[model samples]
Target: MASFEVKGGNKLNGTIVPQGAKNEALQIISAVLLTAEEVTVSNIPDILDVNLLIELLEDMGVKVSRPSRDTCIFKADAVDADYLASEAFRNKGGKLRGSVMVAGPMLARFKKAFIPKPGGDKIGRRRLDTHIIGFEKLGAQFDYHDEEGFFQLSSPRLKGTFMLLDEPSVTGTANIVMAATLAEGTTTIYNAACEPYVQQLCKMLNSMGARISGIGSNLLTIEGVTALGGTSHRMLPDMIEVGSFIGMAAMTQSEITIKGAGVEHLGVIPDKFRQLGIQLEIRGDDIYIPAQEKYEITTFLDGSVLTVYDHPWPGFTPDLLSIMLVVATQAVGSVLIHQKMFESRLFFVDKLLDMGAQIILCDPHRATVIGLGRKHKLRGITMSSPDIRAGQALLIAALSAEGTSIIQNIEQIDRGYQYIDERLRQLGAEIRRL
Candidate 1:
């Protein structure tokens, strides 16, 4: 129950580097189990969720060594099969949503896997239907035990087949792709998630001797290989962190530069912030955001109210919607934030309302925020983090508020963000971990 004592009303000014992508780290690290050779992964984020995933691997008998702070060399040659069925595994694996990814590599290599009902955010129902159905299509059988709260999956040998996913789930697609790599025949996946994280996994698999095509497309083709070999992979800069920093700069009226933000991979993210009238310049690979007294939200071409909604890849990501909602509080106009992916993600608006932001919670999926135009500064208040994204949004709000603010349950923030308070302090922010 760690808390943060954030003193508001200070503008930040410095350059900060974004950490490795958390979503990609989960997939790439899980893919290591597909091969017995050593895989060297670089630029991993030193975050709570990622560290937990790494510890889970170590407990499963994967030999892991860190040559540097941001790199890990993993050898999964001696993975313990019995450990996956132990109670210790259930308790540790169930706490992390990323643990479900190991099931694919396990079932592919060892012919069996135990998947506990995974948990992470409390935002809404994150169903495993996509993962289960995809695995069944690949000649795997599974049984769910309601009493034990786990799914037992086994397959003597995997035979690849075609699957048109009901939804393009990122984790589901990554899981299925890893399984297909070791199957007997070629597998074709239609309507697959083409997020950068999924694409990175596919690329890393290809480098490990798996034949995968359609790197950045909705359709993927995987040609089964007898065995995979080791390779090195470097994660892309975390786009979520980039978007969060952009929002923080706007809300706090700070002059900050984000170093090596992977601008090319950040599709529609910078434009989405620009829609809120936040000005940012692309200086090579760095994003420079200038301080401003006020930023105005833009309207549609038809002069209609601007509505920002989440969609699949090439569209705006749903994870950053919380940051967008928080940034709009001090903008010059109103905007509707529609979180189409998750139902309960918008529930954090109550905290903003308490902070003196003019917001109307339309429903569980949508919120309308009326910008105060910065005429009245937001006042600090005590709050608890509900989830990772919402916690970062609240921290930004607290940094821009008038007085001191206390944020409890900062473990939620630590889950995705690496050394957030330390990095913020480098940018002249007044934040202390309590």
Candidate 2:
């Protein structure tokens, strides 16, 4: 129930470091379950979702210790199978979507796993069929228990096989990859999600003695190893957070530099912001966005209206589409934001409309924003955060407004952004957590 009391029209100026990638942390942390040996992970983001997964691991008898706030040492040698069937585990495991990841490693090493209905941002329908089907393809028997609301999966032995995924799901690919790492034969996954998160997992698994190829492509091949040993891994800086900072700097007319942003791995994020006419400089591993009174959107080469849409990796990320929509509010021209990944994410634009921005919600999947061009400033209003990305988008809107705005459901914001209000305060933002 925490809320952010944000005073608008404050021009932020400072250097902010993006936290470790939350998406990658979930998969990497779960991979620790593959071995009983010590696995050390550095640059872990101190956020709710990631912490919840870590706690779930601790509850399952994984020996975990933190050498630093951002580093975790885990030894899963004594993971308790009984804990997975316990009511406590059911409740807690159900609360985090990432907990499903543990099922893969658990099934791979322990031969049995149970997954409850996973909880996360209610953006749209997130299916687990991909995971279940992939597991089944790897020789696991899957059964759904309606009374307990859990998927019961078990196998005497796992043998790898070829799989063509219906879609390139990031978590699904990670889960299946972790399982296939210890299978009896080789596995080939085509049309797989090859985002940086997946590539990092593959690289880490390779270091752990798993044979994996196609590091950055849709086709991935893995040769099963009998056992995986432990290795140290570091997470990349969150690309979503980096993109959010770019939008915030542009909308608030602030000069801010994001340090250690993992620039090379960002993959089209900076260019997407530039599509909105947000100027940014890539220096070493940092991104510098300067203050601007007004920016304009870029049109297609044939003189059609500009459109920013989400696609698979190497394309614009859906997570940052919300930030792009919010940043487009005060820009000099209009742009179409196509949120193809999720249907309900565009619903949050109604809140921006209340603040006097010109936006046309063409449908559940699309929004057309006619930038005010900074001729009129957005006035503050009370709003509630809907999801992690939308919440951050709303916070950006509130920060660039003309007065104080109260944002409820900031817990959603905390689940993704680490100490966001405190970080913004360092940039001279007048934000209070209540």
- Please report, as a residue range, the 10-residue window in candidate 2 with the lowest summed lDDT: 81-90
lDDT of each: 0.95, 0.94
Q: List TM-scores for all candidates, in order.
A: 0.99, 0.99
Q: For residues 9-125, could you state the per-residue lDDT of candidate 1 as single tens digits? A: 999999999999999999999999998999999999999999999999999999999988799999999999889888899999999999999999998999999899978999999
Q: Which stretches of candidate 2 lie over 4 Å from their true place?
A: none
Q: How many backbone clashes does candidate 1 have?
A: 0
**Which regions in candidate 1 have their CA more than 4 angstroms from the true location?**
none
Local distance difference test, candidate 2: 0.94
lDDT of 2 by residue, 1-434 (tens): 88999999988999999999999999999999999999999999999999999999999999999988899999998999778877898899887888899889999999999998888898998889999999999999988888888888999999989999999999999999999999999999999999999999999999999999988999999999999999999999999999999999999999999999999999999988998998999999999998888899999999899999999998888999999999999999899999998889999998999999999999999999999999988989999999999999999999999999999999999999999998999999999999
